[model samples]
Target: MVWGRKKKRGGRKEPVFGGVAASLAELRLNPLDRITVADDKPASRAAPRKAAGPGGDGSRERKPSQNRKGRKGRARKRTRGRLSRLFYWGAVLALWGGIAIVGVVVYVGAHLPPIQSLEIPKRPPTIKIVGADGSVLATRGEMAGSNVSLKDLPPYLPKAFIAIEDRRFYSHYGVDPIGILRAAVTNVLHMGVSQGGSTLTQQLAKNLFLTQERTLERKLQEVELALWLERKHTKAQILELYLNRVYFGSGAYGVEAAAQKYFGKPAKDVTLAEAAMLAGLVKSPSRLAPNRNPEGAEARAKVVLAAMADAHFITEQQARAATTRPSYAVKPVGAGTINYVADWVGEVLDDLVGQVDQNIVVETTIDPKLQSVAEAALIDELAAKSVKFNVSQGALVAMTPDGAIRAMVGGRNYGDSQFNRAVMAKRQPGSAFKPFVYLTAIEAGLTPETIRQDAPLDIKGWRPENYGHEYFGAVTLTQALAMSLNTVAVRLGLEVGPVNVVRTAHRLGITSKLEPNASIALGTSEVSPLELVGAYAPFANGGYAANPHIVDRIRTVDGNKLLYARAQAAPGRVIDPRSVAMMNTMMEQTLISGTARKAGIPGWTAAGKTGTSQDFRDAWFVGYTAKLVTGVWLGNDDNSPTRKATGGGLPVEVWTRFMRTAHEGMQPEPIPGTQRGGPLPDIAQLGRQVIAPAPAAPASVGGPPQPVRANVRPEAASGLDGWLVDRLFGGR
Candidate 1:
């Protein structure tokens, strides 16, 4: 019975093995039973187990044992199935977590603030210095127009800008989503962030209201503001603001300023080529300042023109024409104190309009042509003698007798330094002061024909010497003045009183303080060049002194009358008209036959005086034509004596050169109240003449011609001759 039972289990186990083999075969797997059998070790173990099983029937016993082994294999397979399911679910969770992280990163990036927006003020453009004929000279302030509506902007302008700067402006909603995605992809591929994807609105926002900080927070703020602006304002308004607020270098702060600065024209008048050039400046202002880098600016303009053609804003031919258009012409700004005349005008304005920041156009009396001539003359003279005298500085001032300063040069080169010697410097007038002394003497009853001795004179222990240290015994007052004889001037000053001379100088507009001593007769008093010119103008204007002035009128930019420059009341007569006439006559002699004769020009009446200060520190020539009065002062800044500089050397040379050019094409007029007459004729024909027929009467030899006293002279006659000689040749 046991054997039969064992056989039954064996049969069942065999079928089980056979079934497993068949399943393995269907699964195309290597069979474990075959493998174990081929290894032979498993076969031997199986044989032992089968032998011990079921009443020593090995096959029957092995059947039960195989069943147990199969069960264990099935249990192990079920456990592995659970682990596989767990692994699959874990992998799905990890993938979703990664996706969440990426989403967070993208969200943060999109929200970051923009890095570069700053707002600047909007101001109206300033008009530059245009010649009376409409040529520009210099420009001031930025120019800008009111913001235009979106529909008002030319479509081509915005379209061209977009083609170059930002193409996705309208569709991006202030932040470019695709641009961000592309940047992200690029960063991933290259392992670095290397691109900026700012949309137009973002760029506008940055320009309007942000700093250039490369921070995420600022970027987000920029995006928010850009969106806000796009929704609130039209596209044209944004563009207008951008154009007006952009910097174009050359001290220009807007499109209009840039246009005027570079092209010497207004923004509304700019050509397409000029517009492109201005637009190109948006990228680099200093590098392309119209005055600094004109070549680079032109090349950049061509690039902009090419871009315009590519965007179809213009045809290729149009682009070529625009690029070929001549660069806008501009005049260089005057170097230093370009508005020097304007500054003097400002001083007059202070009395008219008070201190205010209003735009004012002052019509001045300055003749630009004369001004140029005067400047050139002074510069040329200084340059020519720079090595000889080591004199590198000088000043020239020309004015109408009515005190209108027509032309002035404050220094040799205004570009080098700006110390206005013509107006601000105060130095000894030297012999220029003698005119006041002579005027005083004339007021005290002296005349040009009066005799004065040009001998050494003692004035309260102040011994005045002639310039050449040699004295003439006797000379006319006019001759003494023409010679600038120091001794004669001291004697005349003592006779007239130094106080009276100072007072007379003040009356004539000398205004500067004078020394109270007799030395003042030799021009020891310090006076400014302007004061000296103004003072001498009385001689030119026939004894009346007109206050020096620059501004004629001031008006607002809108043609509103701000201030009218009516002539101020004249100062009282400083000297008698006759004294002024006589003084002018003597000065005319100075130009014709005196120390300042070099200043004489043909057919022009110029009366001036030469002055060399003590130690040769300052040299001066104060003179005037019938129309103009000019003063020149040459000296060292440190008061060191010039080596060979004198009033007659370069000062008179400059004066003559300047006057020749300044008065060119202008008719010469005689000074008012001047007497026109030649010198007195010789007196040889005054006495009666005897007939030749009277020779027959010589035989008579009647009365020995009244016993003509041999070697016997009348006391009265000798005393009279001596007195006349002393008065004519010893008083000076």
Candidate 2:
């Protein structure tokens, strides 16, 4: 029946579908509609009798078929997530490891040690110069050098310095490790490389034993040296060494020299403000020099003051006051009394003592007042004669007759140069040496009244002439000396023997070599002005010759005696006391009535000699009062002759001016034995017994029968014999 219904359904399906379609005109229907058919094989499922209730509910109760696949997917997803996490962490770690390695390399390179150079001594403090009042005058140290022990420094000064330059100086063992670390960190943070973390000891090490190279090697060397220094010295000692070795500008090395240079005062006397200024100069001296840049110096000083305030070394009020204080005005260095005299003394020391370092302070015999007056007078005189002569160089020396050099001038402008003309330059003395010749003749029993022919005399091949070619015939010895007659002098030198004159000059302190010829009397021998003054000093010092000396004694800064002047007994008489006295009297006459008359100082018994060399190349006026001997030399440094310069010109003026001022506070004392019988008569005739035949009567015969020839003349007179005859008999 179902098969028939099925067959009929197949036919009827179209009709049902048409009906459904017609009914479904309001509702559309799908084309494959199924009608339920009785199952023919329904009974075949009863074999297992397994009931499927709710279809897949049983499958849900159990593991589903796709559950294993789902579990596998979940496990794979978890595994994948875990693998991704591992990869991400690996990349991060790689990047971090690279960054750490870079940092380590950079740090090691930055802190590496550097190389070393230079060998500096770690010496004790040096002795220095001090004034009479115990004020520092100069120093002896390294360059701009000197030294001072830690114990020598004032406690407060070191404290102040430490507080400002290095606050942790006492705590550190030569170097501050913490400070170094902090500096490193800060430098790295800011990428700035300017800051330094060196301790005081490190700085000293750099200054003393290491180069100032800005490298890690140098820094490491500095650290080693600093540690060694700390082990060797106490902190106080280190600080003192630092203070002394540190540069304080203006060529000053130590605190004492700096104090003298900047404040014109001693280190002990330095004011708070002055000290701050000097301390400030250490950072950059040239840029902060008060002389070159006052504003910058003042600013730096303020910074130092601020530091002092911060350190509690001074109060803020004090710092402000110091900052506002006017800049200290320093006098130019080397501007002291006796600039010329000091230079001359230095030269003399070169011979008497030895070569000295520039740091040496040579105490001289220069009288400040006397030197001032001499310089002023010379300048005024030269200015007055500026039209006639352009005299720029002048020198003067004054000394006690016993060879105590009292005053000196090497040149008019001491600041311009330091060639000491007084002790170094050898200039012709002109007529000044004539007195030595006269003295020689006097010592040989000749007096001031001795007679000599002043005619045209031919001495060997040398013809002597007067200054103006005018001869004063038959003049007395006093007249010849007073008039400075060249012919008379030549004749007298020949009479006394040139060797004797030279020897006599030596006795009077003339150390220069003298020409053993007729020119000796004419000043052909070159002599230093100081030597001339020393030579003439014996005449004023009662015939006693003394070696000229500038230094009286030498001592260390701590008052330790280094050397003392050898005690010398009064010099043995070089000339007869009577002869010296007579020479002194003659010189007095020369000063009063001779070429040096212009040098006459009223109310003072003075003696001097004027000299003008050939062509006026060297002019000299050497003189002496009862207490002082002075010599003035005027000429060009090149030895060129000045236009109108002469011994009686500017030289006399200089001598007179200095003497006038030198004797201002002193009373005039009479020369010893000057008033006693004046000078003795000439005995030249007693010794001179002419043997030649009375000059053949000169054709004018009958000259009082001509005194009988005392001695006979030799027959074969020739060469030396003829020359001797000619010289002794005043041959033309």
* Candidate with maximal TM-score: 2
Which residue runs of candidate 2 sit more than 4 Å off their true CA positions?
1-203, 206-227, 230-240, 249-252, 264-276, 283-325, 337-368, 379-388, 457-464, 555-562, 565-568, 665-667, 678-732
Task: Give one digit per residue, the lDDT tens place, for model 1 in 383-416.
Answer: 7886687676777788899888787677766656
Task: Estimate TM-scores for all models.
Answer: 0.61, 0.62
lDDT (tens digit, per residue) of candidate 2 on 1-732: 455533444353333545653464435322223254543242233222222233632211334565567557766877999999999999999999999877765564355343133344544333243332334433433334346565655544565566556778889999998878877988988899644678889988877766667876677667767877888888877887888877766557778767766776656666677777777777777677776666777777777778888878889998787667754876544533355554344345556445443333434444555656766776677668744764667777778777776666677665567677877889889989998899988988888777776656544456656665544455677767765778778777877888998998887888888988868888999999888999888877788877886655544444554433535676887877789777877777676556676777678888878888898787788888789888888878887767857777778887888788788778887665476754533323222322332221211111111122223333342222434322321201
Model 2 lDDT at residue 423:
79
- The whole-model lDDT of each prediction reads 0.68, 0.67
Q: Give model 1 RMSD, 1 decimal.
A: 18.1
lDDT of 1 at 587: 77
